[model samples]
Target: MVDENAGAIITVFVLGVVTVLHLLGAVPARLVLIFGLFAVVLLLAIGLLVLGEIRDGMRDAR
Candidate 1:
């Protein structure tokens, strides 16, 4: 089973880093926004995939 908590933590960490970079002017505003959105989407996709796996596993167990 995938670790949902770990995925969330990593997503948060990446978002924080992106924000810091934006604040430091290391990355363009548009790029930062894109990355942030991408991170959120990725996290959601991963969570869904994990849930699907869990569901499949449960079905197989029966």
Candidate 2:
């Protein structure tokens, strides 16, 4: 649980920095959105799978 939270924290921190930079006009909006999507979809998904919180073929069963 702690390991998963650490990974999540790192992901969130990276995304937050990107969002802040975008708001400050240093990063493009499109890039920010792409970063957000990648972090949410790919990063989190794979991380959870690796951590065994999400098992195979159980994503939409709820």
Against the hidden reference, what TM-scores do the models get? 0.68, 0.59
lDDT of 2 at 8: 73
Each candidate: what lDDT?
0.82, 0.77
Most TM-score-accurate candidate:
1
Best by lDDT: 1
Residues 6-58 of candidate 2 have per-residue lDDT tens digits of 77778778899999998899998998888788778856666666767545446
Where in model 2 is the C-alpha error above 4 Å? 42-62
lDDT of 1 by residue, 2-45 (tens): 47667777877878888898899897788778878888887888
Residue-level lDDT for 49 in candidate 1: 86
lDDT score of residue 34 within candidate 2: 85
